[model samples]
Target chain A: MTTQPVTLRRRRLHEIVSPLTIPLVTLLLFVLILLLAPASLPKLVTGIILPGLTLAALYFLIAAGLSLIFGLMDVLNFAHGSLFMVGAYIAWSCNVGLDPLYPNHWPVTIANSNARFVIGLLVGTLLGAGLGAVVEVLLIRPLYKRPIYQVLLTLGLVFVFDALVRSVPAWGSDSKAPIKPSLLAGSLEILGRRFPTYSLFLIVLGLTLAVAVALLLRRSRIGMTIRAGVQDSTMVEALGINVRRVFTGVFALGAGLAALGGAAAASFIGVYPEMGLEYQLFAFIVVVIGGLGSYSGAAIGALLIGLARTFSDHLVLELGLPTAIASASTVLVMAVVLLLKPGGVFGAKE
Target chain B: MPINGRRTFQIAQSGIGYVPEHRAIFRDLTVLENLTLAERKRGDLRRSGDLIFGLFPRLHERLQQQGGTLSGGEQQMLAIARALVPDNRLLLIDEPSEGLAPVIIEQMMAAIQQLSAYTTVLLVEQNFRMASAISQRYYIVDDGRTVHTGAMAALRDNKPLVQTYLGAA
Candidate 1:
């Protein structure tokens, strides 16, 4: 009888502790940071917050699509990063007529104007979306029944796409920064902190897209189909929805989003041939930390990792630690989250 | 007719409700959304609500709950409820009593029997008792081929055939 009471108490304790793991760890991390570097508070608000949100926004842009595509199709698209790289290269070409493959070839004075820049962004996003659609139809469609083949095909595409970009005479292996539009080139003062205007634009764009996607999933018929498809796709087909077509649409949507994220990232950090791998690595981490197939998990995971990385960077600087700690912080957080909640905060329990 | 080839949705659009085996309800969606998604014709949606609620009153209480969170019995109700929401001319129910407590199975069998009054029910079941209780005609297939065909009452009289094909029930 006494043992039963103890068992009940232990179960109660677990019920309470399990839900608080992430928040409690987050609080403890903040307390430790404050104690270790008390002098960095102003910098935290002034420097870290906007940039942290901007980074989070960029992470969300890539991770959201990754989460959806994985959730619905069960395909791990390794080419996502390469798609982002291709998008940046294409957008760059549109801005300045460097690549013969794009609209403004060299000696075409139609390049470098603000109108051209706007046109570049539009063309870049649309073409990225279009390329994603084509890839789905031509390559992904045939391999739906063979999951291993899908993985191999996407992994192969990563190398092929990277090599294809490098082969373009205009793109090459060098890094090129796209000039920011005049509207986004300036900086804004927030709470006496001057922040780049472009970063704020990214923050707004990411937030807007997140809401839009969430609303689409929650409210639309297509969204219903996706949610159902994720659970049991064959049943969805039996229900009379064109599930094959939905698969293609979702793959294209995910690729397009990743490409747009690449175009946006081009302005923040100059576009290099290898940039896609860097962002893709982080995008994978964000997806894992968020829960593999959960959209809200992706958004929350992005915010957590974004802030954690930014704060760690500041800590490294303030404490004179090696710069590698900043890079390692996100992985550490992921490890902790996985240890506590193996399925992720929002992922379905295994 | 050849049923218009492989596109299942087109066949569904022609007003056929399918309750596949294993209660294939979307685990992620709410009970209401499950019903809402099956609504092919908006004009007849009001009738759907009345029919489903009338058949399985327990679902009305769990409208907001996710399908996966429900008990197996409840999930089966949601599956049957989902197929019935649209204005379907025929309902093809597959093994509603596959995995259920005797009590739940009785309730499900009763619900299916009640629904047969509203639409054509083509039930495929291995349970001889359930198959005989709810159906008029009977077709017993062995190894992907029909071994016998007769009325349910006639099949009940054939003790040897029941023992050979269906086993003692």
Candidate 2:
């Protein structure tokens, strides 16, 4: 990048352009929405923001994990989606298994539904993380240098996981809504707009997790070390760190975060065999747009995608355009971004 | 053969403070984060930071700068500082003078002497002037095996042998 002769003007322009791009694009979208439908803008925004935030938050879960693993380990784990699917399935099982205490298909009135929700998340996450560590140690670690071998092995696991889910009589390729705590089931009046309580909960959870992770990387000792390991693990090893152990721990953490997202999204997406690949693809898109190693970039990328999808769908419908076009809206947004900045919104060189 | 090859990596893991010929710096991390990584792996980071900064003050000034962006001398300083992180009984430095200016090399030699006062130094150096200036003893290797072992004084005395083996050090 530096080899190109840089005039002072270009450097100043770059300084101006770098920070303004994302915000300007975001504002342009809002302006377009306002111009297209001023009367329903408030209600439309409220409604759109719910699904938009939900989608963005869930995507962050998967994308963040993907970024961490890909950045640190240099291992392309094609089977990461399996971890997400396992999480949702575990949440479903936990819900059904606790039926005697809360009753199936009924919101709990006696025993706390919130407690049940926490239990489901905890169990699902634990199991998902365990599966991830086992997979990393056995299948993925050995194939780091051989991309072809990694793809073949992990691609095989992806099918194995999907088939395993299909084998379960209750799950069986079909989607089923996992239990939701009664507390999070309805809309809540916030400011002037009534917002879905679950969407708000997810937004809060997602923002908190993202901020917490960013803080950990910027502030914590272990986080600093892991970031360093991403660049030069040999330097870390020479410094007396057991880098193998750190990699395993991080791989498990990344998987655990994905599982948490799945468990949390179970009530939203429902547990199913194909659900992993769906979110996994969305995660890929988010990472590509956000820049692979950038956490904040991923968050912004997710929001852009979620909001774009919702707005594009609504706008297309209002204009009486083909609804089929709505499906490609997110991908279109990604393409546009790529066309402008080929390295992604935040990607550096590679 | 350079001990900087793969076999040296095995020796590198055994509590040795290995400053590789390539420096092995974490290019993406900031200077502060680079030192923090080393100290976090061993003992107290703040204590080590205070100690390392005393020797390589340039690192303290560029704490927020990325490792890749630093000058060659600064990167070398970071490498040596990282090695000093653990309670290392011996230091294994490979070509500290490589790619540095003469003034920077002199500064590095001074830092090496300071480090040696605290612990044993097993310096893998090619620069004979710097090596003879500080080394008490020397070993010359050919084809991955030791060919000569003697005092630095003896190596200096044997000019023709030194010239034949190391090309007029």
Candidate 3:
């Protein structure tokens, strides 16, 4: 009895301190790297850091949904990447059109590339959200009681989505680069370095979405249901909440975000049949590094990974190391983070 | 007889508030959020705040603290307060005294006793003293079957029945 108050106070203290550990260590390491690296500070900031932030923004686009879906439902949605690919394809079709020979019937034509690009993003997000809702109702809702079947169903969806995209008459497994609007096509100088204006657009978009999502999670009634449902869904149900409906809502929200990410990526990297799978892999890594079901974790994880990959690639180019090392760096960081904190940086303690 | 609804949430929506044995509050949420989410309809919580706060003033004090941070006794109070937030027709309280300190149990019993003046309580408890203290009637179940039922006063005087079933009342 005498020790209880002390224990509770100590626990509160630990809770306050634990979340800061990873970010502080990362910042310290970043400072150390800055001091030791041969490249000038301005060069590193322009050439490496800005690009890293851009990539991080893109990763967050996909990973946020992955983290939310996994956190709430405990389902490892392999098709998340496939959904990302579909979004890209949709955005591509909107911007570039399926066939050049056919009269461009799309209301906003290539003549209005900027409007078309914005329209493509909106359409992709809406359709992606719609598709996600449909999938949850038709496929996932029934398999809630059986864990393995849910896994199989989602895994199978990857192929289905991939095949469906490839089957599109003009798309036909070909990589297509959508035309960039003239307004955003040019480069902008950032801190004495020229950077793609579109990359900055992506960074801004990512940060905006992150803030919006955080606000939703923190403030709204639906957000309350989500946070509570994530912790103990059965109890939420017992408290008179329709957790199943929330599940569907979350799944749709995640899908919409991933689709938005894909649409945005299409403008940056162009779109291909396998674009989703490539981005999905990094998104998964980001989710794992940030902690499963943790949004802030995913955001930070994206930043860490984006910067890690960028810096490692630069180092590889400068030192003439194997290209494989650049790719391996993110995974190496994951392994080390897992070793130190197995649940991910923001993961709930087991 | 069948209840009004099919699902747990549906039944909950049908005006039944359940306080589970383990005090299954949303540990991650603040005490205020836990109460706010319990509202069945818009402004239900605002309408019911006076009664809840009156019953458990400690909860009002710890509005911003996480449910998990609360002590067992405080969690029990929050659980009961959560149930009271919605205009529940009947409250199903399970083992309010289970694992609580004696002082906390006495306070819980007093709160239940006062609330009973306004609401119907279906309390399932093994603590005979706490049960008898707050209740006007009693039922004895032996192996999932009710073997005896009577007024609390009658049961207290019936020493043989208590000895036979409850083993030294």
Most accurate candidate by lDDT: 3
Q: State the displacement of the C-alpha of residue B155, model 3, in Å, after optimal TM-score superposition.
A: 2.9
Off by over 4 Å in 2: A1-23, A26-30, A33-39, A101-110, A190-193, B1-13, B27-30, B40-51, B60-69
Decide which is better by TM-score, 1 or 2: 1
> Relative to the unseen true structure, what is the Cα RMSD of model 1?
6.0
Give the number of the best model, judged by TM-score: 3
Arranged by TM-score, best first: 3, 1, 2
DockQ of each: 0.48, 0.39, 0.56
Candidate 3 — which residues are off by over 4 angstroms?
A1-13, A28-37, A98-110, B1-5, B142-147
lDDT of 3 by residue, B1-169 (tens): 1255388888888888999999988777789999999998889889988888888999999999988889999999999988888888889999999999999999999999989887888899888767987898888888999888889888888889888877768
**Residue lDDT tens for model 1, A1-350:** 00000000112355455635775786588568767876455567767766778989988988888888888878778888887887777777776673333564677555335566566666777788889889989998888778899999999998898888888887888889766766788898877767788898889989998888887787888887777777777677766667889988888787778778887777667678898888888888888877787777788888888888888887898899999998999899889989888877655555
Q: How much DockQ does model 1 earn?
A: 0.48
Candidate 1 DockQ category?
A: acceptable
Model 3 agreement with the true structure over A130-200: per-residue lDDT tens digits? 99999999999888878899999999999999899989886788888755666789899877878889988
Candidate 3: count the clashes.
Answer: 0
**lDDT minimum window of 10 residues, candidate 2 chain A:** A1-10
C-alpha lDDT (0 to 100) for residue B142 of candidate 1: 89
Better of 1 and 3 by TM-score: 3
